[model samples]
Target: MLLAVGKAAGPEKTLTERYVERAAKAGRAMGLTGFDVRELPDGDGPTRADREAASILAKRGRGVLVALDERGKALTSEEFAAFLQGFADDARDVTFAIGGADGHPPSLRQAADHVLSLSTLTLPHQLARVMLAEQIYRAVTLCIGHPYHRV
Candidate 1:
């Protein structure tokens, strides 16, 4: 599941839905279940990000936890595919968390099993959500050796 803070609207929402749907269909074909996106309300102030982080951690599962941050380690699409495949092979679940405007706090980063960055550049929360969804689709395709992820 992809946990994102803030409601997605307009083009961002459309693209996100498009990729998520694509991912769901392809994933189902490959026996990957539960491709769902959960949206959370955005908060404010200095504690907003921390509050959101806490909420995410609490809501996440016992499997692999990944926090999205601009400074996190970057991975190639193929590498990401392998990373997720390793967990899938182990029958472990994976959850991805996207923080709000203030970004994830240090505690959240430390608590996450992996801090992943789609790009080093700072992206808006909604756009970041779209990127994540698309990458997830790509990862699934790559794992199944599908054409969606052409080298």
Candidate 2:
């Protein structure tokens, strides 16, 4: 299963919905089978809600945790493909956590098995969601010998 936690803020509400819908569709096309997206209640400061949701989702699967953070390791597409292949080989269920505007709470970062960087530059939280979904679809496609990945 693929689990993501995101804030329900920024952008027009309808635009956000559309991006999420596109992501879900992309996930389906990639044969993810189980894709779960959770919207956490907006918090005044850093929220522990993503971590809490992650823990719950983690219990439902084998728990290969990957968090998207600017400070994490940056991987090329091939590297990402290799990482996913290794996870699949280990028969682990992967959960990719996307945190809120303030970024992931300290506890969540510490709990993550793999902290990944999508880019060095910061991205808007909502845009990150759509980018992550697309990358996931791309990664899965690469793994399955799909021609969708040019590299």
Candidate 3:
């Protein structure tokens, strides 16, 4: 789920929604059960992240937790595919957390089973969501032996 900066407006909202749809379709086609997105209110400090983390954890129950942050480990598409394959092999749920501007709380990081970085360059939270969705779809394709990923 994404902790959006409140509600988005106009084109930004549209683009994000589109990416979500594409991701869900691609994931399902690749044999994932489904994809769901949840939204949390925007906030200023670590407390907010803690709340977001709690909400996610409550919902996740028992599953692998992945936190997205700039400080996390970077992986190639193939490596990401392998990462997803590990969870799939174990039949576990994977919950990915996207924090707000101030970034995630230390508690959130501590709670994460894995912390992954999308890129070295910083991206707006909105764009990060889209990029993450696209990469997830690509990873699924790679897992299913689809040609969507060239390498």
Highest lDDT, which number?
1
Which rank order by TM-score, best down to worst?
Answer: 1, 3, 2
Off by over 4 Å in 2: 1-3, 7-32, 46-62
What is the lDDT of every predicted structure here? 0.89, 0.65, 0.75
RMSD of each: 1.0, 4.1, 2.4
Worst 10 residues of 2 by lDDT: 1-10
Output the better candidate (1/2) by lDDT.
Answer: 1
Best by TM-score: 1
Clashing pairs in 2: none
Residue 46 CA error for candidate 2 (Å)?
A: 6.3
**Count of backbone collisions within predicted model 2:** 0
Q: Would you list the rank order by lDDT, best first? A: 1, 3, 2
Model 2 Cα shift for residue 32 (angstroms)? 5.5
RMSD after Cα superposition, model 3: 2.4
Residue 140 error for model 3, in Å? 0.8
Q: What would the per-residue lDDT of candidate 2 be over residues 36-123, giving only the tens digit for each residue?
A: 5555543453446555545534553556878788988999887887887786677566877776566776667777788899999998
Candidate 1 residue-wise lDDT, 1-151, digit = tens:
8889888899999999999999888877667776788887787887999889988988888888999999999999999989888877787888999999999999999999999999999999999989999999999899888998876
